[model samples]
Target: MSGPKYLGHLNINVRNVEISHEWYTDLLGLHTYDFIPGRAAFLSANVELSHEIALTQVAEGAPGLQPGQVGLGHFAWRVETLDDLKEFYQKLLDRDIKITPRDHGVSMGLYFQDPDGNGVEVYYERVRADWYTQENIFTNEKRPVGDFPGPWDELAAD
Candidate 1:
């Protein structure tokens, strides 16, 4: 008989599951489908997948996250265009979320912190698989928007 296989949900332990629950739901636009008060909450990106994110409330007096810890680093959500990313960048700034924008050779990314200080990245890929190249590995070196060309200049004129 064939076996079922899949990468299941991601579970995160948060200081206050309720607050983190609300944050993820509001920020990422996920919906909470299940909840165990004072313990955990399961959130779904859509109706199909069981749960994309699960949050468990840490016991009272538990220690908070320490920097440089060996665990989950960050997660990214991809957008379609640089203009879309720019829109979100402004929205995040208006919300006073700490944000850092970067132009990866293959993508444009915005990094920021959630309420819990968890690193999150929202990005837009510049090139498709057919366009990627070995010579253009994205480096941490910064390049402001004025320094590089944007793809939508012609489209914007109309």
Candidate 2:
């Protein structure tokens, strides 16, 4: 019966991580608490989670994201539990919504496109203690979404 709680964070894809990091931090008055050198930075305005802004260097060879032509990579909302994720997944299917469920190493994510072809990600964060210890927190390892059998008998169209 649980559901998405609130806007967890935003993952912005930028061509230059260092410059964007500087831009965002200065513009927003955020402080960097953790980073993977030039690849990514988790910044904070001192939110409940480790960070509020997730900045990632654009993938090699990928064209720079521009306004209008740019989709906001993906925005995420957090569900309270794994059960909440499964229930929401089934509901999305019940309504015939197309969704791509993903396990983002740190969180369980359901990636899907909106009606206008914009990408969206609805996710359930793995309970911190369950996913990682304090010392080893963030990761960018890509993995396929978990294949959880739905409560509904019907399968969604890909």
Candidate 3:
């Protein structure tokens, strides 16, 4: 069986490369692998990889995506455990970024947007048995998230 293994990288357009570069690096903990000032930047969590995300600068004052727009909805970054998710959740709060927390039965997710309004999600998956089963592969049930941090506490009632 020959098929693609995983997503190699992603490229997105931003209003300013320098701004978005700093934003992504600081927010996602990605380091600069390569950069072209005022034009583009390549960032990665793994130094081994050339880049996991590439940011290309667009003209200033360009309009951002509007509600109900038909386009790339969002991209996700997966964290390892509940603790990691909590740490990241704190980071988002420290940065004063708005968040939408969701419990997908098999995982917990924090959704937010970047400087240019690019949707991004950070999630922590539960054990494989919770999500890898045939019948329970994709679940939208609201499950209790014990020990949830901050806004995630609301999910406890579900």
Candidate 4:
């Protein structure tokens, strides 16, 4: 028998759908396909999909996921290029959002939390031809924040 072709979507609980809706749309550039005000909302990065993420509002004071929680750790999105990642990094810096950067040898990513404390990661992976080899395919390393190199310097000088 065949299994599922790909992971379809993720549904997460939030304190308020409207608030998390704004946060997801604004920070991660996800477009909302449907929203039900205070109750629930569905969003997606691809226009073709109905929704890649669905947010269901719980109580306003619902407890958040803790560090050692046995549930969802985080969800990640992959970008197309290093320049795109740098641009996003700048946006986070401009917004004063606390971020943790990670380097996985084949990719670099930023980790940050949403308004409801849901962890999210946005990253750019190196093209397979550029980083993949027969014997090795993975490496995990901590990257210092603000180390993304790009045209930010020129833009800053402008």
Runs in model 3 lying further than 4 Å from the true structure: 139-158
Instruction: Give the least accurate 10-residue stretch of model 4, judged by summed lDDT.
Output: 139-148
Q: List the residue pairs that clash in candidate 3.
A: none
Position 109, candidate 3: lDDT: 89
Residue 92 of model 4, lDDT score = 84
Candidates' C-alpha lDDT: 0.72, 0.64, 0.83, 0.82
Worst-scoring 10-residue span by lDDT in model 1: 139-148
TM-score of each: 0.73, 0.44, 0.85, 0.86
Candidate 1 vs candidate 2: which has greater lDDT? 1
lDDT of 1: 0.72
Instruction: Tell me the tens digit of each residue's lDDT in model 4 across 1-158.
Output: 99999889999999988889998999888989999988999999998999999999999999988888898889999899887888888888888898887766567888998988888999998777765353345432332334445455564444
Q: What ordering of candidates by TM-score runs from best to worst?
A: 4, 3, 1, 2
* Model 1 Cα lDDT, one tens digit per residue, 37-130: 8899998766687787788888766776578998778777777787877776766766778776665557777788776767778888866663
Question: Cα RMSD (Å) per model?
Answer: 5.5, 13.4, 4.2, 3.3
Better of 3 and 4 by lDDT: 3
Query: How many clashes does each candidate structure show, in the order listed?
Result: 0, 0, 0, 0
Residue-level error in angstroms, candidate 2, position 65: 11
Q: Model 1 Cα displacement at 5 (Å)?
A: 8.0
Instruction: Give the TM-score comparing model 2 with the true structure, all chains together.
Output: 0.44
Error of 3 at 34 (Å): 0.4
The stretch of ten residues in a row with the least summed lDDT in candidate 2 is 136-145
